[model samples]
Target: MASHRRIRSRSTKPSPAVGFTTAALAGVTLLSGQSASAAPGEPSPSIEEVQKKVDDLYRQAGSATQEYNKAKEAATEQRREVDTLLDQAATRADRLNESRRALGTFAAAQYRTGAVAPTAALMFAESPQAYFDQTRLMDRMTDQQQQAVADYEAQRAEAAEQRAEAGERLEELSASQEALRTSKQNVQAKLAEARSLLSRLTAEEKARLEAIEREKAEEARRKAEEKARAEAERAEAERQAAQKAEAACAPETARETAQPPAQDADPGSGTADGGHAAKADKVIDFARAQIGKPYVWGATGPSSYDCSGLTQAAWKAAGVDLPRTTWDQVEVGTRVATQDLLPGDLVFFYDDISHVGIYIGEGMMIHAPKPGANVREESVYSMPIHGSVRPA
Candidate 1:
């Protein structure tokens, strides 16, 4: 999530990114000349239609937010890689310089003493083996001198390789940063456009719109709960059937030993007991702690968040590194069917796969909604689901 810092208004600057113009949003078309406080007539657009339009705008903004998150993640990784390469290159260069200085001192010593060494000549010779026999150099050089020659050659090669690697990493870092900046601007523009559309509504219309949202959330919750209950019953029945089958096949003493411990249900924890259960619990804890924070387009923080920013941060807290966008996030972990979704699973939304939320069981999720909204828990079904994934 971005910080709670004030977003610079686009009032003075014209943005080509937004599809809607300010003039086009001057009035609420859904009202159809009806008073803001009164019910709409036959010609007025239904409240449902208006709500759908608003949802679409929010979805568009979410897509841009995902792009921003992806670029941010890439840039961060590139920067770290570049830094490491630079450090390695520096170390290699120092070693190369030391080797050169050592070789120089050896040469100068030979010059002062006027010692014409056969091995030194052989090292510079076109064919070392052929010259070794010609000059009888093989028996002349000590082990330390041979090792020094080898070390010097290795250091020089390492320095050259490190310099090339550093150059490549630096170039990649530059491209990543440029993409990050462009994605940030795109998210801001989409958010600005969404805010513009919502801002055109009267206070009464806004209240009514919120009411519709709540109703949908409640409806989704109900359906999710019903599905959960049915699944539990089916699981329990299967478990009993399996136990009975095992008992029938086993001897009486073995049957008693084969029984597994009974499991307890904790409603608050969304994940089932498995390999990732503990990590998932930590992720859920971090996500819950972020509730009510403001949604800032590029912010990932203790204070505010964008959608992917919040998810990335939460999973990070759990000691798992997740990619920054819903698109990439969806590609991670095992693909889970909608019917098998559990707590700690990341659920994505929309045809473009723009939005995401952390499932907290019972078909509910915690997500950082668009601008003017806060990080909060809502039904996973509140938006059209693209897919789900569980990050270990």
Candidate 2:
């Protein structure tokens, strides 16, 4: 758009000439121009003079240089951002590796003990020392084991997410670099022809011009920092609110426990999660009926859905509200630990936190997988999980 302005041309040659204008139009086939000499309108400039003006404009218009410089700087910064993301991904990957080992060890232990069994009611004591083996740990898992699976899956998912973000940034940098290269070449060509004419402009003008650019860049940096700080404050406030709500819920849970044990783990059974028992009951009832449906990306309906979509649809059906995107939905609930996970929890996934799903007790979750995948129930351990929340 900036390049679309109508530039004033060496246009004197095309104007209607004044009285008795006798000028040789070099490329114009004119026999005598006695009758009508579109007399070199306003004093025809000599060809050489016109050439000089053109050369000057070409020299002064460092459009390419300006554009290329901006792109180059952006490319450099993007490289840094990409590098930072890569470093983060690598660190996550290492953690994922460690988690994998832990998961494997746990799996082997269960397998050797022949402790994992479907239709086998499994439970564990509070501590590893108080650990009890199961005939089958698969059907029902302890809160601790469920938490472990959630953590392991979360780490793996986080690593993948980070890698994907870094890869996208790399692509952006590559494209920027290519564009900058092309701009530099164009500027160089114009510079050669325009420099001779560029002398007409005073040094003060050039200096002032550069100063303006510097000011704009400074302004952009200030805006960016301001935005970052604002977002951080918002996140902190949300966290505090979640803490308050959790505190309030604790006593109520204690009261219930004094009367009857909380049966939160409902394996493959919808509407039976203990977590949902006390919260979002209406929403919980709606979501339970959608089990066994295939997932559809971004589709919102009774037939299929991705994680956030399914949650949104169910909540909508219950007259509650939620954001459309998982990232957006993350802020909608009370933050809770995996150890204290309950049914009807809305779990979120992130390295970037761009995905979300609903926890369905017993280490299982319902979600829509990424491209080419369908909506289905999967083990919380089957996918990387980050954290979860409940409607406050």
Candidate 3:
């Protein structure tokens, strides 16, 4: 049985990454007209419809939050790259300046020494070899001055290239920052609309909506229990079948072999399954400790977290690093079926794969649900499941 935990009731809200569609606009229109009282002959929207619209808005907001996270992470990485390129450019510029100074010194020394011009030396020489031997101007210049000039040109070109790269990366960072802002705005707008829709409900309507939510949660929980039982039975059956096969082969192996079969391997030998289970325990422990923390969008911290942020932090505690967004986190680790979910496995939700939770057996998951919500344990089936993953 799942342990009882206090689930807080708060305003349900989310952010938006993509713009709302026509259906969303229609929902807004319907919600805008809702109130505690309606005129006779007017049709008020049903509590169920309002509930659904609110849920959809939250889903959209979750999607937008993930996008905001992605953009923010991208901007951080690009900024780092820009800094590295600028540093390289500065170093190259300094080298170029040194080369120029060296060439200037060579010119100053030649002028003070009353050195003859190459052309003058060449004209006065009796032979080509005599010209080269007498002045050694071309040879000496080739050895030092020519090489210094080459170094200066190379350094200048390299510095220009690095500066150009830094500029391009800076532009990319700006675009990412813009995307982050847009996603933030979209999320705020969606949440505002949802809050408005909920606030307009009468006392009776609010009670009805709460009842409907509870009913849905109960149904989801029932389904999850059924699936967990089924999966457990299947696993047991497979294990028994494997054992029987091994037993049947024992006599034949003894008759054919001169030596006895080796004993079973040690469980503590750091087997793959054992290692994964150990890490999973750590991940679950970390997630459990974070319950009741506030859900702050894009935050991955000891104090507060968003959905993906919580998952990333939890796995990081287990010595596994997850990406900053749900989109990327989903791509790592091996995909598993919902029924096969083990404790500490990551279960993603929604068609957009915007939300994620750490599976903690009996179909329950720990997650940072939304803006007004806190990190808490709930049924994985509470939301539509996109997929599950085993991150060892």
Candidate 4:
């Protein structure tokens, strides 16, 4: 589970590196009397449309929350059951301690050769009745110890299963919230865009229009809340899926038994003389040549470039077409551990996947950070490091 880790808001400020702007939305609006939303005497806030969207949001939200609660309850019950079982096991251990004391005393008495008043034979007995008593004691003690062991093992297994289930539920919660936020943003953006250029309509028409807007705003907010809940559920589902995928995406490793040890390997250090570093050096050099260029999200040219766009253009000069997104770019090659990072490696950031930069050796990297931001050489640590990725 994420615990108290606040969900990283994908939202950002306008200056670039990575951010969002609903400003684009204000420029878009279907305003007062500009167009008939429907037939004459028709109010666009029809019961049908509002009901449908509202119902969908409610249903999705309810289902997701319900599932989360169920999973949570199941996990709680499992935890309680495990604790109970462990307590019981501990009680049995106390019994085991008593048994050990009895056995220890019995052993010492039996082994002594002294003329003791109460000998092992006397205390434990030698007749058929006493012999039977000793045999039964051995059997009863062994059974009790075994039962405790079995109970503890079962409880441990149940506890582990419960934990996994809880984790899966939590992941669903995160994903659902993410989706909800996105959907709400979209709706809000669309609604805001509608406000501009609505002055063309008459007063009565405007009032009618305002009423519709109020109704829509309320409905949108409600749906957004619903979306939030749904997002929580979906997040968990996505996390479970990712976990499963990562598990299945195992890397191949050589297996050997009793093989001679190989020579010690060094901490890979920084850039090397040849191979990837050589090609990477050329790309870096070429990118540096374009240092005076402006940052453009999707632009790729002599004039401007977005972070990924710049990397793509540079790589193109070096004869490769790396995938565009930072997430995809990470898979371009084997991942370089943070400690072993080198020049030409690509470091990425999160939130809309808006920032990307190419490593320039040391702790330095080059990137066209964000729109209105100039292309420059910046430290990888200057911004948050989601992680560093290498091209394949």
Candidate 5:
């Protein structure tokens, strides 16, 4: 592993009697009185600092992954637009060719009739029509010939415009492709830095860090479950209250058997309308199959995925098109409150809205977490909730 020579505190307060080296490589965490080493001999930095640094790097990687996804989406759209323009340009070129052939026939008839002057020729003149009209040569041609010449000129102009538009689209596509490359590199660099930091830790320290993460994940899951239960209970109470009010006001014969309020429609339960249930199930099915696939920064495929890529593909499998980044995806569907998130709703996280996952009800979600991890289910509350959207 590549190591950066970096000086970090051994402790908040170190023994002043010990000698310490000041500098190391860019990412190496040097301890007081001990040079940072990847070998087991180097004294470990505080577990807390290592954990924080790793988490920060992973967050940065997630941000870069979203950037990559956005650029990729733009590039995909730009390429499509460019292709459409190219097709239009080709069609225009064909039209122009046909127009030129019709005009050529007219010039041929005028040539054989000796109506066209030797010096005032149609083929060599800058303004063919003006020259023919000025020399009275157009008088010898049929009305259709005159129209053909005009059509040829108009077709040429239109073709030129189409070609120009195609050129501009190609330029935009090129820029978006470059941006995609930069975003991919940024993600890789951040992940590499995180890996380097992890490599410096001792085996016991690594195990402890993993334990800390597991504990946090469990805690988050517990809290999300608790919140979901509370929302369900609250919704049930409201439904009963409304039913009682209806019973008090209506005649016994006029009253219909009070059915349980539709749980699917309860805003607090985050369930979808019954009509969307089948599609949402399909989305969840696709997402679940992707579990264990490695989380590559910009991938959106059968083998690997970035956060948004996974959700986008899952929904696409269910015949819904989602934008390629969390920021844009959130805007595509109806906004849903956190408590109302149903399966297949996209749950965005973090203040920047850089991360997202597919909510699978019960406060769980399937997501491509970050580089070095795999697609898996975790609590929606595992990270700070920015918002939610139901991309039905």
Candidate 6:
């Protein structure tokens, strides 16, 4: 696992920590503070206070949304498994019934012929093999009758096992369903609180909040450009150093180095990078098209999306299926440093990795920000960095 690295827009200035601890404290304050219904003499929470509280609520909601997505995905898989198990159990049960009918017919035929019933013979004998040996029953019975008895026993045992397995899957499905419900409730509650906080702000205060966001974005953009420049410079320096090393080598050694070594070529190697780049293009294009969509909690989008939902769908457009939720999404693809992020790379945020966005270069990303917000381009540095992944 990659460690979470903090990336600030302004390295010189002290930035407020947006870690979970601060968010949790802000949440408690929001719930306990007099901002909601301040008396005439009491003062209401300032715009910054409201902003912090609201941001925290949105972050919490995002976390819960990821949890909901995880549980939902699990439930879907569990339901499919349960369905298959039940179907197999039913099929086995049908076979068992057929075998029982065959056994019944054999018993009836034996009773009518005044021969020992198969059930009675087995009950009186110490064992089936002994009974067969003593009475020569194996020789007397038709091959079909012996096969029917074997099929009945095997089918009965198999049917019982299948039913038990199905029952266990059903229980797992129930647990997943319960988790889904709890996560859904948590997301709804957090979003509701965030809405309430925003609603308490005056029109002017809201405008100021938007302005603050814009300013933050601008700062992040500046920092991103600076970082990109530094990375480019470093790359150029490395290239120059390599060239200098080659130039300083002995003439014979340089000739040998210039001539590439012979090795077996991989047939598919040539297209690997191109294929990855093409897929990345598709992913970026898909994400760009959903820029204005609403951020619905669990939506995978034709119209709306959540953070991970949008990423998963975008990658799906490129023929790569990603796991639902930021937690799982972070685990896919090649892990890359924040400074090495490329367009279409999945950039994760926060220590818990509850949020993700598709990097579009120069530190900007297109993401579904939060509930009541539309998908839009934002600076990746707006939140603490939790590393990145290249899905392709």
TM-score of each: 0.66, 0.33, 0.79, 0.33, 0.73, 0.76
Off by over 4 Å in 4: 1-273
> What does each candidate score in C-alpha RMSD?
12.4, 30.4, 7.9, 22.1, 13.0, 8.7
Local accuracy by lDDT, each model: 0.70, 0.55, 0.78, 0.53, 0.73, 0.76
Whose TM-score is higher: candidate 4's or candidate 5's?
5
Off by over 4 Å in 6: 1-36, 39-43, 115-138, 142-146, 231-275
Summarize candidate 4's per-residue lDDT along 1-392 as a digit string, tens digits: 21211122332332222111122122223223243244588655533344344333322322232233334434455566556656665665665565556556555644552344435545656686876676577567667656656655656665566566655655655565555455445433433333322323334554554455445544533443444444455557767887887666654213323466666576564333245655776778889898868754345677987576688788777777886545456667766665555567777754434456887643456787543346776545544466776673
lDDT of 6 by residue, 138-159 (tens): 4465567888999999999898
For residues 1-392, what per-residue lDDT tens digits would candidate 1 score against the true structure?
Answer: 01111122223332111111221233335323433432456465555666666667667767777777777777788889888888888888888888777777666654653465666766766896777565543344334456667789999888888888878888888887888788777766765554555655677766667666556655776676676565565566767887888778788657557687556577456343454667777888999999989877778887999888899999999888987777888899888887877668899888999888898765567888666667887767677888899887
Better of 3 and 6 by TM-score: 3
Better of 2 and 3 by lDDT: 3
TM-score, predicted candidate 5 vs. hidden true structure: 0.73
What is the C-alpha lDDT profile of model 5 across 181-233, one tens digit per residue? 99899987887776677656666776676667666666776776776676566
TM-score between candidate 1 and the true structure: 0.66
Name the runs in model 1 displaced over 4 angstroms.
Answer: 1-53, 113-154, 204-208, 211-215, 228-282, 298-300, 312-321
Output the lDDT of residue 292, model 5.
86
lDDT of 2 by residue, 49-73 (tens): 5444543433233234335545766
* Colliding residue pairs in candidate 5: 4-25, 4-26, 4-27, 4-28, 5-24, 5-25, 5-26, 270-340
Model 3 lDDT, full chain set: 0.78
What is the full ranking by lDDT, best candidate first? 3, 6, 5, 1, 2, 4
Compute the lDDT of residue 314 as modeled in candidate 6. Answer: 95
Question: In TM-score terms, which candidate is top?
Answer: 3
Candidate 3 accuracy as TM-score: 0.79
